[model samples]
Target chain A: MEKKIAHFTIDNKECTATTGVSIINAARENGIFIPTLCHYEGVKPAGSCRVCTVKVNKRHLTACTTPVAEGMEIEVDTAELNDLRSSVIELLFTEGNHYCPACEKSGNCELQALAYRFGIMAPRFPYQFNERDVDASHPKIYHDHNRCILCKRCIRIIKDEKDLPAGSQGRSIFAFNQRAKKVKIKLDDRLGKELSDELAQKAMDICPVGSILVKETGFKTPIGQRKFDKEAISLDNSINLKAMKEAHHE
Target chain B: MSKPVIATTSLAGCFGCHMSFLDIDERILDLIELVEFNKSPIDDIKSFTKDCDIGLIEGGCCNTENIHILKEFRKKCKILVSFGECAIMGGLPAMRNDIPVKECLAEAYLSGPSTVNEEGILPNDEELPIILDKVYPCHEIVKMDYHLPGCPPRADLIWEVLHALILDVDIDLPYELIKYD
Candidate 1:
């Protein structure tokens, strides 16, 4: 069956997308970047972080969860939207104990990259400095609640291996849950110990912030060579090209 | 008119930001020509002698002395800039924000690994500035006109901001100059 194509206008630009594709992915395909923290590719959009909020038919909605419809009018980039996004970033900064200088994921952190792109010298909100715990009980993975933005990326990507048969390949070793305004990610101790180095690194990479880190392997890369140090996080190839131009100019 | 007067201080900082300021290399000549230093560590001036056009503050408020000096700067300077991560967000000193003051004092003076005090006594001299309950960023205590964030803010960032402020021109912060760490 042929997929139905939907045409829409985003930020005064006409774009075409498939009928059921999310506005974020559709925007990406058309070279319009929609900044997001929680919506990872291939994972179902949780819409927990409202950074990707855009106006849809005069109503504000999360672009990651909202499906594109025929003749939909979307406003993705505006001064108001940018202000809202910056505020969200500031709230995330003040709501947690994000001491970037000491974080293992300092140079490569997505949250830090967003702040850099937005030129956030400091958060406007009052710092909460809430006390949080760091769980290093697992052999490989370390969870620092201080840097978590509650994006739930790890919860969606890492599955629980408890129910799987013994020695089953591709079993998940991480578990996470939210309760009473508190959210936590836990490692299945038994399975976590058996996790391969590659999988452990993948878990560390999956985390947008420095909340989850692999033990014994931090600051391996020098300051100038880290991921986001040379280039900004790009949602699409066009954005990457733009960043490349700026980097070249610099 | 006379050169724009600039004052600077390090409250609860490591002086790393001031070191980065010097990292502007030979441009120090240009800075010296552009502005006159008033109450700065570099000039060895202990107190503000006159009202200044700009004040560059390093580190956050961790003690009574920090708050007092910061208030004085706010009153004496027309524009106050938080010069580094410590001044903007308490930086490394903020690590103790989670621990109680009593625990911190005990660890530092009495029960710490390197403590040599046999009397188990805490320092309570009138000369010593009393420690606050927690380290606080500069803006929380007094209005901060600007903030430059870095472990020590990048030399280029400091240079650009200072240059712009002196010239009364709008600052265009390049992407490479901005960093949190």
Candidate 2:
């Protein structure tokens, strides 16, 4: 007898599949769309920005983080769902200093495209304007506190993929003061210091908003030419897994 | 069997709600058949009886006019639903309560950007009602039968609730839709 599988809906289209598959991946496979913010396939689902909120049965859920169940009815479009998503996107604009006029990642930015797509005419809510200060720590990485949505994509890339101390120093998980306790102690031995500028750049590339920008890449790629960046960013799934394993072993 | 008589009104709101209701698209006919919307401004119905099955009061009661209208609905409707987040949680209008009433008045009248309140604009004299310290939900002012929580309650959810009400079935929240952890 065959094992029973779960059913997940993608943009109102339904499909039956096995477990251990994310809705984002399943939807893509079935030619359905579930737009994501902090999720890159084969990398990790950060569930930040809350953009891909699809209705499961009667709920507005983040399609990336939410696991597929045996039977789920989903609705991906409607005024209410759009309203909630649009409001979330609007909140992202209002929460920080996302001034696209001066942004480094302006054209290559997902936030701007989504805003255009959603017809965000103006900022409805008065800007909270958190007045966040910059973090000038890394030699190459310039932390513009203003653009940081605090999505922690850099943190994930740093910790999981690159295995670096700077990535492990997230405020929510580990505060600024506690940086030296775990990963920071290895700093003295230069052997574990494999955090390359390219790795950092990839993390920056994965960032949906202009929160993370490669200091050099800005204005080089141009706007419309950098289309592939917006094209479904799934990290490890389509990459050379063998090379990744060999790199880890050495 | 008489259909549900629904009366809808807006107070201190942008009326984006009524606009959103029209956005339901093709469902408006179904909604109309489900409920007898006799007093909606959209219908241009000037007069309606208080003996309504469902009374959906949008916006929050700030002035005497709102209070009077709320009381009238309470006197008339059987089920009073605090429609939008303003009616439910006092919304952005309610958020103004965070400031001192004196400061709010000062900003509106003198220090504000527009800052000019003509005779009709300014509520002058002792007769002018004092601002409440904080915005209270409709539940605080009057008994609410059911609440549909949203900035503006989703048209689909509203439709579902109305359908359930008409069928005498319960409007239950599905667990899959909420954030537990």
Candidate 3:
């Protein structure tokens, strides 16, 4: 059966998307940018970060989790929404010990990239400087609790594969331990021990911050060459390229 | 009209930010034409002869002396700029923020791998500045009018902001210039 199409107007621009497609994905298809941190491609939308928020008829909603409705008028790219997004990014910066200068994932980090996109000179909120732990017992990967934003990307993406004799199609190798501020990602000793090098790298890649890192692979990319270093974080690469050129000429 | 007087100091910094400031190269000549140095390490001025137009702070406060110097800059400078990651967010020295002050001193003076002091004595001189309970970003101690965030903020960024401030123009920092690392 053919999927029903949903027509929407984002920022007063016409857009058409299949019913049930997320507002964020639809906006992306329409060449509109909605910044996100917790929402990862090919993974379930948790609506945890609230960075991709959009206003619909005076109601605020997470674009990543909210499915598009026919004739829906989505309000994005407004000054109010941008400030809201920037504030969310600032809160993340303050709540966590994001010492970007010393972080191994400094240049490539998505959280840091978002801050740059928003021109956040400093977080308005005072730094919490929370004392978090580093779990390095696993030979393949180490989880730096200090940098974790509780986005749950590793927990959702890095799961046991199907077709193996163990045959647990989606058994999570990482799980949440404790609660509230004390909460952290706890690796399953049984499954985490059997993780391959490729999977270890995947876990690190899946993480938005410098929380999960592959052992001994720090600083592989030099400054000015890392991801998000030379380039601005944007859904539209052409726009960024134009900005880059203008900046270069100056 | 008198040129704007600018002051600079590194509290607990690695001096990398100051090095980046000098990376402006020949642009330094252009800068000198626009601004004058006052109470800055660059000129080795021991005290502020007069009030400064701008003060560029290069690091966070980790000791009582850092606080004193920061307060002095606040009182004397019309505009205070946190010039690097350290001054903006406590940078690397703040890594010990989680550990107790006593424990940090013990590790540095007693338990660290290389220690020749058989007597197990920690430095306690009257002249030495007392370490703060925790490293604090300069803004936490005093109002900072501007902040340039980077490991040692890009030299071009330093030059551009200075250029704009001296000329009384809007600081339009390009996207390529803003970086956290």
Candidate 4:
């Protein structure tokens, strides 16, 4: 079946994408950048982080979840939107015990990158410093709850593909445990046993924060050379994995 | 016109930020030429001799003494800059913020593996500063004019801010210089 095309304007720039494509994808197709924290490729958009929020017809909408409509007028990169994004980043920083200095994911973490991009000298909100648990049960990785932003990318991404998967979806390796305020990502006790080194790296890579970390890989890259350390996270290209690998190898 | 006077103090910090400040290298000569040091650890001044044009505060408030000195700096300095991650958001010391202060004191003095308190005393003395319930960033205790965020706030960034503030110019921080780690 032929797919319909949707044309839209993002920040007054003409953008076109296939129908059902999210605003973020359409913007990306047009080389227009919409910053996101929780949004990841090949996974369903959760729209939990709210970092990708954009003004769609003067109303706030998550760019990753909202499909681009014909003649849709979307506002991105305005002062209001930038301020809103900055506030979200700040809120995350304050809400979590993100000790960037000691964190293994310091230079590579997307949350820290966003904070840097926004020029967040200090968070306006008071630090919560809530007590969080760390899960070292997994052999390949450890989960530091203090640094988590509750993005749920891991919960949505990591799956038991080792089994004969019926379709695109597989048994979830990570899931949300507990309820509001106490909500956190939990690694599947049984399925997590099959977690390969490659999957472990992927989990750490996709986390956007230092919450999920591969064992024995702490501080692999030195300061001033890690991902997002030399280059600011631009709108078009975010979290360059190849460049990060090159840095790690070097 | 008289040179702007500067005062600096470390509250709950590791003095790493101050070390980074000195990491300005030969710029120390330039900094001295640009400003005068007043009540600062570098000068060994115990009390403020006069009102300071700028005050650099390192670390957060973890004790009663930190609060007292921070308030004193707020009173004495015209423009106060919270220096480094500790002063900005409690940093590593804040890792214990979730645990009870009693637990912390116990671990430090009474119950920890390395601790050797013969009498099992918690060091409750009037001479010792009273510990607060939790670590607090400098801004929470007092108004701050600016904040430099980093483990040690990259010496170049500190230099830039100093230059801008001293010269009364806007800070044009390069993308690379503004890092949180």
- Candidate 4 DockQ score? 0.87
* Candidate of highest DockQ: 4
lDDT (tens digit, per residue) of candidate 1 on A12-77: 899999999999878977988898878776667899989889999899999989999999999988
lDDT of 4 by residue, A1-250 (tens): 9999988888888878998888887887787878889988657889999999999989999998998889889999999999999999999988878899888998888998888888888988988888898989888999999988888888887788765746657878989899899999888888888788888998998899999999998998888889888887875448533433555686
Better of 2 and 3 by lDDT: 3
Off by over 4 Å in 4: A240-250
Q: Report lDDT per candidate.
A: 0.87, 0.60, 0.88, 0.89
For all predictions, the C-alpha RMSD in Å is: 4.6, 12.9, 5.2, 3.1
List candidate 3 segments past 4 Å from native: A162-169, A236-250
Best by TM-score: 4
- In model 2, the Cα lDDT at residue A224 comes to 36
**Model with the higher TM-score, candidate 2 or 4:** 4
lDDT of 3 by residue, A1-250 (tens): 8999999899999999889988987887788888888887656789999999999877999998999999899999899999999999999988889988778998888888889888899988888888988888887787888899999988887887845666455788889998987888998878888888887888898688999999999999988788888787888542223333555686
Name the better of 2 and 3 by DockQ: 3
Candidate 1 residue B152 Cα shift, in angstroms, is 1.1
lDDT against true structure, model 1:
0.87
Pairs with backbone N, CA or C atoms under 3 Å apart (clashes), candidate 4: none
Worst 10 residues of 3 chain B by lDDT: B171-180
Better of 1 and 3 by DockQ: 1
Model 3's CAPRI class?
Answer: medium
